[model samples]
Target: MLKLGVNIDHVATLRQARYRGREQGEPDPVRAARICEEAGAHGITCHLREDRRHIVDRDVFALRRTVRTRLNLEMANTPEIVAIALQVKPDIVCIVPERREEVTTEGGLDVVAQEPALTETRRRMNDAGIEVSLFIAPDPPQIEAAARVGAQFVELHTGRFAEAFGDPAQREEELNRLVEGARLAHRLGLRVNAGHGLNYENVRWLHRVPHLVELNIGHSIISRAVFTGLARAVRDMLDAMAGYTGGMPGAA
Candidate 1:
């Protein structure tokens, strides 16, 4: 069965909008995580960006103590963040690309291009007993590089597939990339996961990607939580992803 990793990064995003100077709050990411866990989410995800933008150090630290399920920390490979990750020791570490100018992660990490830097960073995280994953576009070179760098998993970026939303031809083309990428990575023995732009609508079709073990979704679920409540929103997603293993990752 595929697992659902609910990302609570945007909960902190809302909180940060008000408390730019310090930690003051109404919407708490930790609390949001608790609700997601109670609702049967297999894991909790948070991306502690370099700019201190969205999820902060305080939140990750608190989540370390509070999250009952697995804590998958998405981060960039930098000395400061890697240091914090080692100290925090989250269950899983997914290295993603980051740019200060972009509103959100614009694309996946070019693991093929940055293999040297990622090689060392992956070593540090793995040495700390944390399973490492690389967030890369579903391209062969990047996926191949991830294994060479010693990452245990690779999160296939689905942004392009998602952007093709209503266009059938574009969606099918992007889906082919993901299917082929996941198949190749799986053959290499890399545990595969996918994220970025996965939600109620598009997520159902993701079951089509072979060998996807987990889906780390954030914005869409959080946005739906505004109307349906977090628990129900999670359940709805769970319901949407019912039978994802038979040539499709999720059920109707």
Candidate 2:
């Protein structure tokens, strides 16, 4: 099965929004994770941003102690977060780009441009025995740079592919690039995972990408939960991946 790493950031976002004026059950991300586990999520992903925007330090520690499945920590390459990661030591850590102004993760980390800094961060995280994944684009240079930095995994950002869903030609082109990138990464001995902007409509679009072991989905699944419930929403997406019949876009 294609593993599903459910991102509970939006769950925290909702609670934070409500906490602006009212309070309820504290709206813990760990609790939301348990709900995801019970709903059949293969793993849990949380980003501990510099701003404490959504998931916080406490949430990361709590998940490390609580979750039965793997925990993938999303963070930027900063001394503070890197130090915290050394102490918490989740199953996996994905390094990403961070900006105080952006509403959310707007794009993939420019690993090619920041190779030296990224290389050092990757070394520290790997030495601590935590799997390091680079959240990069489907560009060949970025993919190559990730491997050179000694990262064991690379998560291709699917924001472009998802946005292109409206235009068949654009969507097909983006999917093809991702498919090729995944194949190339796997050949270089790196685990390939994809996420961001992926929804029910484009869930199975990357099945043709070789060696794709996991997909981390957030906003779309959580939003759909408001209508279909979390478990059903997750299960429905899993079912789509398992039932994919067209041999993916570039399965040649």
Candidate 3:
């Protein structure tokens, strides 16, 4: 079955907005993670950005101690963050591109350009027994580069697909890109996980893209929690992810 890795970064975003520079805050992300796992999420995801935008060191460490399910730590391939990952040792580390200016992650990491550095980081992560995943756009070169770097997984950046949801032609094109990306990644011996802008309505279309192991989602679930509450929001996403039967029949 397809799994849901509930991203709790946005819950920390809300807390930081009101309580930045404070010692304590309401709506703790660690607590939020426990609720998500209890609601049947397979894992918890949080990005510890360099700028300390949302999920912070405190939150990451707290999650490492508290999360019952797996912890997927989203991070940039930087020296400082790499060292921390070695120390904290989350279940998996998804290497992504980071820019302080963008409101959110604008796109995937260019693994082709940064192959040498990324390969080293992946090596370090694996040495520490933490599996490495690269967040890349659904393109052949990036997918191939990820395999070359020895990444265990590649999370296809779904922003473009989500953005094109309103336009039928564009949406189909984007979906095809993801389909081909997943197929290539699987054949290349990499596990597949996708995220970024995935939500209740648009996620139903993802069944077309085969071999998805998990979807890391945050903003949509947190927004929905305003009315339905966190546990219910998580359960609702799992419901939407139901009935996926894996798109490629005999391919693993």
lDDT of 2: 0.86
**Per-residue alpha-carbon lDDT of candidate 3 for residues 120-214, written as tens digits (9 for 90 to 100):** 99998999899999999999999999999999999999999999999999999999999999999999999999999999999989988998999
Question: How does candidate 3 score on lDDT?
Answer: 0.94
Give the Cα lDDT of each candidate: 0.91, 0.86, 0.94
Query: How do the residues 1-252 of candidate 1 rate in per-residue lDDT, one tens digit apiece?
Result: 889999998889898889865866859999999999999899999999988888888899999999999999999888899999999999999998898999888899998889999999888888889999999999999889988998999999999999997899999999999999999898888999999998899998887888888999999999999999999999999888878883552333
- How many clashing pairs per prediction, in order? 6, 0, 0
Cα shift from native, residue 19, model 2 (Å): 2.8
TM-score, per-candidate, Cα-based: 0.97, 0.93, 0.98
Clashing pairs in 3: none
Q: Which residue runs does candidate 1 get wrong by more than 4 Å?
A: 246-252
> Candidate 1, TM-score vs. the true structure?
0.97
For candidate 2, which ten residues in a row score worst on lDDT? 243-252
Candidate 3, after superposition: displacement of residue 20 in Å? 0.8
The order of the candidates by TM-score, greatest first, is: 3, 1, 2
- Which of the numbered candidates is closest to the native, going by highest TM-score? 3
